[model samples]
Target: MPKNSDITPLPASGPQNKPASAASVAMPADSHSEGGAPTSEIELPDFNDVELNNLISGVKLYLQEHNFTEFSESNLFLMLIHALRTAINTSNDLAVQNICKILINLNEIDHAGFMSLLSKKIDIAPYTGQSFAFTLVDQFYSATITRDTPSLISLNFLFSILLQSDSLFLKQLAELQASGNSEGMFGLLLIAQALLRSSTESLHIMSSELIASLVILILKKNEELINTRLFQPIPHAAFSGQSVLTFLLNVVKCEAQHSNEFNNLLLKQLIEAIHNAPESLVNEGLVRVIKRGPDEGLNAGHIFLQALIASVQIKNNKGVADLQVLLKTLSARAGFNAMLLDNITSGKYMNQSGMSMLVQALMAAKDNEYDLTPIMDVFAQIIAEQGKEKVLSALQQRVKYSSTTYLQLLTNVAKDDSSMTRLLNLLENESSHQETLNPAVNGFFSKTKSEKEAPEEEHKEFTSTHSSSASH
Candidate 1:
């Protein structure tokens, strides 16, 4: 939250962006099992109706006994989810509405807690209605972008669980259908529209909101605005006049049909945010993407590389720096570093400045350090493209002013059998000799000569000793 105002309002859109009707976005298919778990079993305990009834009744009694003092929203969050699942099964519209009312009440009592829990596990189904659902989503966006970490965390978890639970439910239905229950097919068809998608479509709206909140936070000048509590709106040239969530929802939904297009657009938006947004916010978001690991469906590393490559192509200095930070932050990640050699060198994304800065950053990073393989590849490519004189000059400059680590790495690259052979030839051809590079070269290339001379030197001593013995 900026110091101006901690409140941001996410305005409602027309019928096109309706939350319950998220079927428009065409989310990826559900391949996993129930509750979004990969297996058939759900993570949550299986509660029969009687047990659910007792639990709900117990909660009601507890609340009544305490004179309706609202319990901790976090504590009641899972309880509400359990109750709502029962409500979904009962198919009683009134019960669903009542559950919705409790959620709203929780929000009213503790907006932070409700927003936190809503961000985490609260589910609003048919009861909230399409319009109401959109409003709730808007509120979610507003609450999330405030940069309140606790609230944002809850909100983030909310959208994720929305997809997971809906996926799980769909998987269960799929398994049931596979079981060959033709008799119930007609009944399922009637409710299929409501049951099939569940909250997935709404989750896109949430995704849109999440992106918007981040954009808002990024547009603020104060780097530490997230930790502040002032209220601020989305004001930036990048966003134009429209708010973050609304625009992204509209654009992403329209482009949903195009597979990589959507992902590309998403990546572009994140890079844009990183260039203009708060470092902390951009960093936190990138870390999450990187942490998602490289899976087949969506690869965070690929997304990161795309961003870095774009930054280099456009010569966005800040963007490149942010990317460097990203790599350094995740440097120790073997999987990420394993791909850096190809990610950086395979494409001509880095010019002289970009490549040099990247190499220096990787070699110089204090945290999340990377191995020499990627570092070696970077300088090797630089030497090949920019010539040995250019790389040697850079190394000489680093040794002159900065640390020797850069100098040492450059020497290591030059000393490699693959790189050294060419580098030595290039230097010999150009006749550009540096005194600093001499001893390192002598130290490295002398290994074979030293090995070959050891036996001869020993033999000479043995022959001398034998001749002296014979004379004696």
Candidate 2:
């Protein structure tokens, strides 16, 4: 048993957000086939009612008595693990639900105690008899939406515990789901969600490879039960001031850079889910994806951005009447839209494609107020990688869309002494000997060329249209 000194109560306040409700958000009513299979011929094993009831009663009694310290005893823990194992071996839903209820009750009654037990370094090899770890995980999944605790905090804590489970536990969860066991898929998601709650820098190091494997298993088995259940709650939780977006950002980032094709498939399914999903989820999912892999969902990102920007447009399309589209616009107006512009300019996502997306997004942004530092950083990186000339030529076309942007960029460069010196040196060297202008330097003339080369009739036609539009 843990000594009394080691059993301190966890600080009562967590996340400080409202508790997540199981029934608070409504999902699409259709029940997808278990394992998302084309036919329901597959029969998964049912639960053992007697064993499950005993396990639940034991766990609940332990929680109620504040006797988790007893679990610290090697022999007691082994017995508990055995019971949990037997409970999962059964295919009975009520038995599974009862076990879940015990876990949820433990969380509500003694969160600190639960976290303490999870943090204990038990020798998991001997404990792996029937994947007791998976059963414990299933307990968490069953309680996720049903438990009453601070919004993402309790969920985040649950995720942390799952991530620390033995690899065998994770492996078993993956195997069960792969074998078309719908219930086992729940355990996989619990692990996935926990990984999402870890720090971004630490996340890639801790769970990238493992998460890749799990995501692959989910996709290969086409486990819609897990996806529909877990993913559906994200937006609702996020919209109600939860940080599901932040969590997803970590998860998506880990998935994005993996070389595995499974990661790619997961990314694809994730995007489709975003398109048809509710507004809050779409926004949360998009933000996370963009934060991690801005280039992954090119078309979806474009549509999402357009949808976000469209909301801010003075003249919106009457045909697009979805509340999500409307909310995206309103969110844009309230500075939520600024996140796109901010990410683009943040330099955190600097790459050829990232810069390309930034330019495209900026063009779409029109007169939207956004910082240019990220773009400037991107410009510097592009010039360094692709050379100055290519970057300048590209900028030249973009500058015509906004002289204000051009001046701001030039002003930013001039203000930085090192960058200014380089600019002066480049200009001087080119001006000294070149008969033809360098591409980078020629950005100043790009717009001029279009104006000078325009045919008289076409120019007049363009001017007339501008004048007419201006008059209106």
Candidate 3:
């Protein structure tokens, strides 16, 4: 060290700085004086030849004591890039993670450029070199999408990096879709997750076109899977591609349940997609969504109901199972049945095809006693809303069930002279065959509970067998 030479700044190998407000641990360097000025900061001292030699000698001693070997000057310059390459190639996940942490500190390693470089490395990696953008998606999926896993740190870095270039990521997804490779679908799902997790920050990217493309790719891919007839009949254990489907469903649910309007739109698209899917798959997705409970207060169950109702609008023969799902969904929600009936009365739904579907569902589940009170409530509302005659007429034509069913309901809710006469006639006709139905005639025609309670003590003990028999 005869004379001072130029000093290259140290490579950015420490934690990258964020806004001080975001840092969890503040430093003494960050301390402000009482006047809101930074305190006298410790600055790096410039070195002269003698000082540099002395520092070098001290560092040499430290390295020797620490048993560290130093590489040559040029070798050190290229060591990190070479090491990162080796780690990725050899699948040394730990080394790659640690190296990524180091690279993030380099000021020259801007997010977009670093991610593009990293993608090249991933493309050369044997396991994750898929046509899609997320290089390690296959491995991440193989690890079962768990939070605690080996590739987690690497994948998280990749996702954060990818989130910065949303347009490019979406364009890659489109390419993946066009190629129709299964690995591409896997990548597509992972990219969608990244995009969803990203907020509207500087690094985050979410445009309408990007969102639509992602949704279209997902729906198309899921449709292709269902078309294979693997998951038909819904929720079969024999379904071959569990991971892919699980990933896609999670993506849909995450987007759908977001507070954003765009997210809600995604929910609508998913429902419509499921509706148009194979009937068995539609049923399966609906049942599974219903079981999992709501997310964002707008769970899959609600979307399932929307899909079921929308399906009747389609120009096709809806199978009995689909109709049953529709009916079951309606019955689960309060006041939905009345709405359905209103739609029917107003000629807004249940065409000949739809009515047949519904009738089949009702017949299949006539005796299902899950909620008798709700069922009765529907009938009561139907009678009060559409009138007894329209309700009975619609039921007789649409529901091919027992006249006794309609008659019993009418009697329970019916009143007034004209309505009572109509009920009396229907009751007499249904009972003419030998009183196969007595609850209606006995409960209504005999007397009501109010009549019995009116003069109980004054009239008598009121020990009427009729009241006891009717109740029982």
Candidate 4:
């Protein structure tokens, strides 16, 4: 919240003194005298001088006191532009840096208006405009490394402007990535990280685009950069508490218009995180990502199922439990049942052990009161396609080594008398089925049999009643 004046001014002569003659630059045509005659050009100060800084300060003060619309047409804008051009031509880093501060202040006053005007002005000279932008980027990198918040905010504003206005800026960034410039790459990551962490609304809007672009660029050049740098924990204390993973997930959540290539990169990263990171981080991260619902280009449900399968494959109980939390959300989506059926029936998850894990997950979802109709439908489809015998045989094998959760799931999926009888007969064939089965499993089987027989009993009674009526 510090004002621009808080920054230490550059060592220069008093504001009352004009720049030396050699440092003077021509004013724009609009700045001519009242009679339409050319006036003396303004004195563009040296890097060490304060005249340009004073002019910028004057503009800042005027903007603070009056409407920015008034300043757009004012004489001060033309003078500031001429001075800015001179600084750009001379590559006077100091003056340009101060101008960045002024731009940041103007942006604070009216973000959209000032940015539009700035973009228009920069478009006048593409090459010089890019040069000016690059200077700001360099300054931004410098401020980033030094943890200069004020300057970072200012320079980042300019950087965002460049991103919005110049297409080549991104190309240059890709070039930087391709060249193996670690410093450049890291700076981009840090800037992006900083932008996401920023509380500013405009910064938030630009940050998503910035992150998407950087991720796409990194994904294209080397995915390893994402793992090593972008995903690495930020060293700054301010960002120490933030998660880059969550930021990326937010991008997925908030911006759905990204190309499939971008969405694929994000999905890949999430899957990698789930597979490699600690169980806690993976579990929590997946829940949030799945809740955000990544773009349809990549199936969030598939991602969830993959993580669920991995958790089961490794016997990570915590992972499985965490994923069960998302069952309802994933199940609510259309075609989710079909997707789950395909995944559980075809991949590594299709095996006895994998199916057992999925069964347990579904059973837990049922116990939690999450609607398992979709999952039950999947189970039915599996039985119909893969044969009830094959499905029963797999569950029978898993029941021997795992918990009775599979038995509970079997009870739910075996909706018909024949399917229930087949599963019970399979369990009965096990010599130790009685001793090994928990009360829950036994209860599930007993309840399933009675429920299946009730309708048959009612039909038999109806038949007897009709016969009695006819005899009468």
TM-scores of the candidates are 0.27, 0.33, 0.29, 0.31
CA RMSD per model (angstroms): 22.0, 18.4, 19.7, 18.6
Highest TM-score: which candidate? 2
Task: Provide the lowest-lDDT 10-residue window in model 4.
Answer: 1-10
Worst 10 residues of 3 by lDDT: 463-472
lDDT of 1: 0.33
Clashing pairs in 2: 46-90, 46-91, 46-92, 47-90, 47-91, 47-92, 48-90, 159-194, 311-329, 345-374
In candidate 2, stretches whose alpha carbon ends up further than 4 angstroms from where it belongs are 1-49, 58-93, 100-114, 125-247, 250-351, 366-472
TM-score quality measure for candidate 2:
0.33
Total clashing pairs for each candidate: 12, 10, 0, 0
lDDT of 1 at 412: 44
Candidate 3 per-residue C-alpha lDDT over 262-366 given as tens digits, one digit per residue, 9 for 90 to 100: 444444454455445665554443333112212222222333333323222223322223333334434443333333332222111222222222222222222
Estimate every model's Cα lDDT from 0 to 1.
0.33, 0.36, 0.34, 0.41
List the candidates ranked by lDDT, beginning with the highest.
4, 2, 3, 1
162-210, model 1: which lDDT tens digit per residue?
3343232222221211112121111112122211122124433444444
- The residue-by-residue lDDT of candidate 4 on 1-472, one tens digit each, is 2111011121223233443221122112334333221133323234324666666566566665656665543434434544555455444556667777777666667655553343221212222222223333434534433434444444445656545553444434322221112323334444444433431232434433444454444343333334444334433433432335544544433222223344445545444444444443333333321111122112334334434433333222333333443444334333443333332323222333434545644434433344455455555555555544445445543333233334444554445434444544555454235455443334334465656444443333332332121110
Between 3 and 4, whose lDDT is larger? Answer: 4
Off by over 4 Å in 3: 1-96, 102-112, 115-132, 145-154, 177-186, 191-472
